[model samples]
Target: MVTLNLVIPCFNEQEVLPETTRRLLTLLDGLVANGAVDASSGIMYVDDGSHDCTWALIEAFHSRDPRVHGIKLSRNHGHQNALLAGLLSVEGDVLISLDADLQDDLAAIPRMMAEFRNGAEIVFGVRHRRDSDSFFKRVSARSYYRLLRRFGVNVLQDHADFRLMSRRVIEELRGFREVNLFLRGIVPLLGFRTAIVKYDRHARFAGESKYPLVKMIMLASDGVASFSTKPLQWSAYVGGVLALASLSFGIWALSIRLLTDRTVPGWASTVIPMYFLGGLQLLFLGVIGGYIAKIYAETKQRPRFIIERTL
Candidate 1:
């Protein structure tokens, strides 16, 4: 039988965790009884240093059930790192990484396992639709996927951190030593025989979203910076355009003075280009500085996360 383990990363999810646990345990029990998975198949919740009763609840569940396990980080190390901590700590035939809010449908788990049994090394739990999200979010998400692809980050559209991977695939993933971890982009690079399972994303059961707008922006920034260098290339393109424009303008002014013996004089003409060029220079500088900051971070070689406790 395929031994399955679910790795859930959570932050401040005390309100919805009990219901999440009850539903997952019931589903796991059914999967075991139906011979779809080994009886040893279980679920693990990685506590991302939530300042709440989240850890206490996980500990309570772990004491009552061997299937329920918990990994506590020293502090909130972000969702991706917490997911990695859970995934790297386990040794199951197949490891499924998901969120504790249960937004990614649990019903899709069985379908993912079926795909795995059929020889897929990786299975993505992709959203069939995002009707529940705000219209802005929906549009932005679609655009983000396309932009990533344009920049050569082969990511599955509408897929978040919900996915399944075989033991070998997970083992291979361990070789990724970069400090900035964008799992969606990194996993596809493994070049495994992958499959996608579509499901409708559910609304969060309770509590505020762990990923707010600020965090979402940071994720997109990291995704672009980590996977592609197109931003740097675009900077070069902008510089070339600005240089050509300056040369053309210089020639135009010089020709006017030589041919007509008159000068074009306007504060608007002078101040406008100054502001525009200044803004562009600052923008490109920020992009270059971003890359330098990332290099400095990687060179330091700090631990991605620290484990405070485990169960």
Candidate 2:
């Protein structure tokens, strides 16, 4: 029997922790009893510095069943890094990542495992329909994926971080130590057999959504910057176009002055070009700053996350 490990990264999810653990344990037990997984199959929870009693609850669960283990980060490392920490610590034939919120269905684990048996190194649990989400969220999510693809980030169309990965795939993922971890983008780049299992995402059983719009936007931006140079290229292209436009405008102004002996002096003549040039300069600066920020972060050579305690 092959051992399977489920890596769940959680923050302030105390309200949902009990139910999430119960469901996962039931699923794992069923899998083991049915001979789908080895008796050693287990779940590992990584607590990302939750302010609530999330860590304590995980500890209680670990005490109740040795199949459940946990690691507590010293500080909040965000979701992606916490997931990475859990993945790196666990040893298993196959690994799966799920949210603590329980929005991602654990019932799909068996299906994901079956797909893994079919030779897929990575299996993404994609949401077929985000009916539980608000209209704004649904639209934003769709737009985010489209923008990612347009910017050259190879990510699954409707996949978040819920997925199964073979041990080898996990090892390869561990090689990526960048501070800004956009897992959706990085996982697809692993170049292995992959599959997707579609499921309807449910609303959170308890607590508010961890990923609000602002965080989602930040993640998307990080995904683009980490995986693609298209933004930098676009910056250069825009700068070039602006320079050309400036030259054209200068020529037109000079031509009018010489040919028609006309002096066109107004806010339109001065302010328009000034605004355009100023905006262009700011845009270039922003693009440059983005690249510089990443460079600065990398140069520090800090660990992606720090683990305070483990069980």
Best by lDDT: 1
lDDT of 1 by residue, 1-311 (tens): 98999999989999999999999999999899889999998888999989999999999999999999999999999999999999999878999998888798999999998999899999999999889999999998889999998998888999999999999999999999899889989999999799999999999988889888889989998999999999999999999999899889889988998999688887887789889999999999999999999999999999998999988
lDDT of 2 by residue, 66-122 (tens): 999999999998999999999999999999999988889888889999999888999
C-alpha positional error of residue 157 in candidate 1 after TM-score superposition, expressed in Å:
0.3
Off by over 4 Å in 2: none
Best by TM-score: 1
Task: Supply every candidate's count of residue pairs whose N, Cα or C atoms clash at under 3 angstroms.
Answer: 0, 0
Candidate 1 Cα errors over 4 Å, as ranges? none
Clashes of 1: 0
